[model samples]
Target: MDTGRRAGEPLVRHTVSPHLTRLLIDAGTAAGLDRGQVMRLPGFDTLSVDPVRIPTATIMRTWEAVGGALMEVGGVARVMELWRPGTLGVWDYLFTAAGTLTDALRASGLHFAVIADPVDAIAVTRDGAGVTVSWDGPYRDHPSYPLIAEFVPSMFQTVASSGAGRPLTPVQVRLPHRAPLSHAALCELYGTRNVEFEAGAPSITFTEADAATPLPQSDPALAAILNDHARITVETARPVVSWLDRFHLALETAVGDGPPELARVAHRLAMGPRTLQRRLNEAGTSWREELERLRQRRVDQYLRETSLSVESIAARVGYSDPRALRRAIHRWYGHSPRTVRQNPD
Candidate 1:
């Protein structure tokens, strides 16, 4: 049976893992932006960014911009810090539970919905002399896609080393796409071979001998904690959905030559300004913070993913003066808009 695909309640909303955030901050500083800028983001209370209403494409661009800076700053050590303890804890649990590397990956997929932004789906199947572990996902067309691709192989290596009780050599990798300049990125990130795009499916085939290893029994206390963590994390998804709905309505109304004020948004939601403020406060956020966060997310996405000039981007994001927008970008990312556009992370 495909235990990985069994239906269940959804996991938590996508969160920015603490480790990833640390890496991004370090990278930003390396790219000449102030490292503190990352902390200044209104909602970055913890390592996780709650209620991530922004599209995945925008998130990818932001990562690329910061990633380049991180690479320039500290290389792999800095990048490695992006893995959060909770995320690693989950990975550890899976590795200890599965009988083989392939089985471990399948377990990871089964639990991936617990993450804020799930990146890969894993499956295992039998072939003539071995087992194949297949990994697949929607690869958004972004420069950072290649960078993120490295996470899979790195993860596999980490598990293999832990299970083997020593460091392991890199294994061959199979990609689902043609080799792009970014393919070189996979080499640097994963230290594995990158096969050209294949139509059958993307997988890593290994001997069945690797599959016979038995996993340690799961610790009851740890399993309980993990289950609780997944539940609490999933609860955050509700707020994100509410935020998206509210933000979308606000954007639609603001586009009709209307003012972008809290009162305006409140009216559209059929509530008084005071009532809206109370509700937002009750939800543990505020109108100003939401507006700024949404704007920053959108601006970052536009700068990294599109060829739109600064002027056009500024206008689209509700800024009439491109210079002011540049300053805002600097405050948020600790670099000028031009720098971000020139070398995306």
Candidate 2:
């Protein structure tokens, strides 16, 4: 972590493609480190190739690992160079499937939540001048924003240029923080002469004409499918006010008070436990499953974001014993509580 910025303390749960972690390992290897060295980093032993859930602190710590390795072996620029088309998994297809640069930009801003949304996200907005992307977030004060500054804009431009099938060079690069690299270095990396520093929100602008250019890989059908999938992924993540949602909400509200083998939750909702069980069954879930899911979510938060001891967390989550909490956490995450806490989901 850079000493210049404040520590990262994110308060919300967000997720990104696990391919980013896999690619980080590859990046370290490409930087001339042996794979084993990268593997030794905490949580790498269990990193998988799906969207990985994360807290605010975890992402900064990850970059601390990546940034240091890259700086030691290949300078900070190589870290930015490591990003490619599929770095974001399903979200990456929006580029190849989009009809035009404008379309791709629109798709990225709209469906970005399915991939790289943190507690807060850098909003992507396009105007007559160009598209503006702000890197301000909970991580805004993070020391690693310097590295994040280079990696994000570089990858964003690569995606934009690749999707446009033309050089979508930024007219100006506006940064929210001080530039760690030289102005000449920034210009060469972005192919932009105007690299503004400590400007407002970190941003980049493309020419209006470049934004309108058509992409060579455009496939309207593929774009539709990808968009539909993104929509569904985001929608399901939200708590809809359906019947099952009401039951889940009740369980969530009652959990803090204390959970009792699926307590008066059903009764409070004006239904018998059996009737609620039947409704949940029809919804393809059960009372126990929903309760477990609720406990799992709370337990994960307590474990990741707090210094609360396992026993304390267990009691708060209504576990009678820490052993039961351990078993339940393993059931939900397929890993022990210690392992889960180390990975920070």
Candidate 3:
């Protein structure tokens, strides 16, 4: 809902997502912000605020400060209570009609289009043997992107676990360039291997095998049930997870060549190292863990899916010494790089 701030008013009057309003409440308390002051701000209605009326920039700022606080407080689940039941039925129809993950993404993009806060764009591409689904648009500040990114994975996971389903493993993301701090929050949330910066696109990638897997129709009754409640869970997780996805993409793009030092990452994120650490901690992860996770995942993917040698793969993923890289790989997967390459596991 629009807060109706006039020209020259402080940015506080910007429209805000209901999810973000909750996050601000949590963050303000954690930051020692006075609750009375927050509630006094224009458009401070805790309930019934229009999602579209909230400005994207305001949401971004709130997310940076709050990180995953809303999800931690169950704000997302609570927000889901507002969605119309028909929303889920519509999503189910799209899920069934789509033939692949790529297809599902495209359909989702279209479905969001009728709404005022639709996804910017969804693009499908082939990287090596995998398919990438890139989503970009004004969602930079909206809670939907993060929520969608997080929930989509679960949706894929659910479909996969259901037997003969196409489960998605999130890969890289490309986010807008301006807000590095916002990107940091995103990286921690999605746990993706890479986060590209200021790229021409913002999207997620899926393996070809995963993308090609058909939707399971074996349990029509069960599918319908799951569909009915899909929006409920999606509403809760969208903001936090989507922000993380964008952050991961930014990190991947920045450090794609080598492991970025804390200072460098902090610089990219426009915050001091200490501040970055504090914010990351609030998000329930550390920079070191995120760096290592990206490295290990990239290393494994290269070894298993590509013909790149250990030395070459090491360099591509930012490792300088093949031996050192081997140690890292062993530590992560409990097997040597050569072993992995030979067996292609």
Candidate 4:
């Protein structure tokens, strides 16, 4: 009960992740609108679209637009069904983070899956003495063990602090695996001294008083809305065919006014050129090759299908001189541009 003095201070606010932007686009698609159309919808065109997060207000406005459009079929519940856990962006630090716990509980039940497994979810429970949050799911050797192990206790600390209005350290912390690297740093980061390394199931335990304390910042209404949105976002999600196709789409979007370079295309995709190159490498391709391929197709089209002079066509495809274009054309085909045009293949 002694949560260090001041009682009426404000809590931190967290922004929604941009993944919800993808969700809004999905909602538009469900209502038979293309992404461009949705982006063009008032209050959205000016917003900078990121692949990770977007403004919560923009999400609300987008929801109004998409939700309104879909009202004819079945209203908000129809929209809610399409929401997924990934779609629910972190609302705020402890406030929103706690809601995520509730949302995960709603989606996964008592047990939370550290990774993915619809049938055998993770368990989060409480008993006569204290509360226990557990993730004893089947993925013991899951790649996310380190991440989830760190995240669970950190989150409990957050929920406790927010609920008690002070830094309420956990009474006990347990890890499913060995303590992560940089052990000294972990203690400093978690600021907790009662950690049990390799406790098998990775759980957090808080005193009965701290666990029962009210999170005044908690808003059940907002949590319900977010949970619904998260569910719906997952249901109607569309998968990107491949990184190459995604790059092509991003490139095409970048070249709206004229020819676009690799940097410009990378910027449009919300990544730096180096990061883009690495991702492309993982996809077994290179940016230079993709750009060259796109240019080749455009150049061939200009030569065969359009009446633009060869010099003008050269400029359009990024060549400075007609001679350079001619040399490249010869490299592409054994004959001159005129011969290729005449042959029409």
RMSD vs true structure, all candidates: 8.1, 12.6, 16.3, 20.6
Residue 74 error, candidate 4, Å: 50
lDDT pick, better of 2 and 3:
2
Model 4 over residues 1-345: C-alpha lDDT tens digits?
A: 111111111110112334545555675578775667667743354345432222333443354345434434433333434554334343222234333333333233321111122223345566664665555443232222344455546544554454345765566777766664445545644566777787877666666676665555566776566545444443333222234544665664443335567888888778898999999898777887766765576667556544568877766666666897798889888789899888864
Q: Candidate 2 has what TM-score? A: 0.59
Residues 4-30 of candidate 3 have per-residue lDDT tens digits of 112212321223235434534554455
In candidate 4, clashing pairs total: 22
Q: Which parts of model 2 are misplaced by more than 4 Å?
A: 1-12, 51-56, 72-76, 233-345
List candidate 1 segments past 4 Å from native: 1-8, 11-33, 48-65, 71-78, 81-87, 118-120, 125-143, 169-171, 176-185, 197-207, 215-345
lDDT of 2 by residue, 273-330 (tens): 8888888899888877777765775576567644568887776666777899888887
Q: Which numbered prediction scores highest in TM-score against the true structure?
A: 2
Alpha-carbon lDDT, every model: 0.54, 0.63, 0.49, 0.51
Error of 4 at 117 (Å): 7.6
Alpha-carbon TM-score of each model against the true structure: 0.55, 0.59, 0.36, 0.38
The candidate 1 region of ten consecutive residues with least summed lDDT is: 6-15
Error of 4 at 119 (Å): 7.7
> What digit string (tens of lDDT, one per residue) describes model 1 on residues 1-345?
245432233432333234334445555665586656655643344445543322332334346557555445543334554443344445456555455555665655565544424544666666565655655655433334444554444655555546544444443556544455445655555455644454344555545655544545534465456545544444454323344445444543353232267777777778898998888888777887766765786677667755678877777666667887888988988988889878776
